[model samples]
Target: MKEKIKKACAIWNPIAGNVRRNEKNIDLAIDFFKQKGYEIVKKATVGPLTATQIARDAAYNGAEYIIAIGGDGTINEVLNGMHDTNAILGIVPMGTANLLARQINIPTNTVKALKSLDNVDIQEVSLGKANDRYFILMTGIGFDGYIISKITSNLKTKYGKLAFAYHATIESFLYSYPVFSMKINGRELTSAFAIVALSKEYGGLFSLTPKANLQSEQFQVCIFHKRGPFTFWKYFISALFRMHDKLPDVTLEYADTIEVYSEEKVWSQIDGELFTQLPVKISIVPKGLKLLVPRTAKHSFPTYKESR
Candidate 1:
């Protein structure tokens, strides 16, 4: 009788972040996996959500591990396809803002992360869903979403993280401070913008939702009640000092589900990619997916406990 061969498939974006540097590291990663007795298959994404199609097909063919090799956006696509599969998810953070990698203490350096994966811990974590789509990180609505949509691929490729700062600085003046309605826990609230966070980190090195963590079953919602540019400036300053939670106009709460809509068409960004337009219903799917996390990241996923 022939023994079954171990298999792993990597779905990556060829143009994500620093392409040349990422590809160089990716080559090294493939060779390492090969030496570890896994038959590795590489799939490069050509267009938006191409990773999803690749991931699904690979998993269907019995790949034991579905590895995503790029930024959080790339991971988001692969995850959507393989989240429900029996295969475990592995990440190689090569994108500009590896927020999820940073949040979980996964090595941002590809080679280091690859070496660590051999003795990793398996964790089943919750994921947030916006209507039909699933997101691993936080989702931004209103102003931030508008900014994310306006950022072109060419801009991100050239300026990296600076491109976001450039776009936000210019777009903030043009933004109209659109208000949206949200229903959470049977109470109606209005806000200029909101962020439903499943992870503690929103952007790299910034903790937007303090109570959020990968181990938690629910999201830590941050809603900005005030509108206008001045209010945004205040929030910005407060956030830099990590004092925004104390602001009178800001509210923080934990919830399993939230209903959001706007009077006009407002955009949304899920896991750093431009997602569906407004009227999105966001909720958490508890222990929805499997992940291979290095034990060095053990501090990130503390035992889940209900705070309420």
Candidate 2:
């Protein structure tokens, strides 16, 4: 007896970073899947949120798997479309920063990423929700959110990840660091910046929230208590050293719900994309997404009730 072929839709964004190179890699990935007996359906996104629409259509059309073939932003868009459906999520890291891919132990190398698909395993992961939008990795308020708002497509296309660093440096001196209040799990808290993180990794291999687990039903909220240039640099240095959690002004807590409000309107970012303004409620949706991960990846399995 032979196994049945699974249907997969590859979602690619032509305007994503490293377009020419990524397109070649995407072709290779598509060919590989086809050779393995997968019924490949190729879909190229035309504009913002187009990947979401394509993925939604693919899911409705009964695609067994929906593969996002760009960076984290592209993956985020595809996730929004597929979250309400039963199609499994697949990723090919071809973007500037494949944060979620790295978090799940997916290789950055295109060939390696495709090869690992031979032993793919499916696992359910929790997602963070802010009103109607769902985020798989992290959400930011204040500083990081403002940075996302400042990033332009041209800057991102030219400098890639360095665009963030460049903008952050300029924003530190020019942009006002606003204070925001959070009602985290019923307790009131104030911070200059806050990150509600579901994944342990941030900005590639760096771990901003070391204890964060995607399989867990809760989020690790890191609050930066101080404001100003010196404090920002201090926190940046600590995060670079992977010791941000040890700083006195930085507080980490586990919560399933958080409500954020600002006296003055402030920006918010979900998975590196500018989402909405403050005065939003965020909560966890446990086992909300099914991801296709490497079979050998330990964290791909559910870790219910496990600390950290």
The local distance difference test score of each candidate is 0.85, 0.86
In candidate 1, what are the lDDT values of residues 148-223, reduced to their tens digit? 8888988887788899988878777778988899999899999988999988887664677988987678899999
Please list the residue runs of candidate 2 whose C-alpha ends up more than 4 Å from where it truly belongs after superposition: 299-308
Candidate 2, 23-44: lDDT as tens digits: 7787898998898888999989
Clash-forming residue pairs, model 1: none
lDDT of 1 at 270: 94
Q: Can you give the lDDT of residue 281 in candidate 1?
A: 98
Model 1 scores worst on lDDT over the 10 consecutive residues at: 299-308
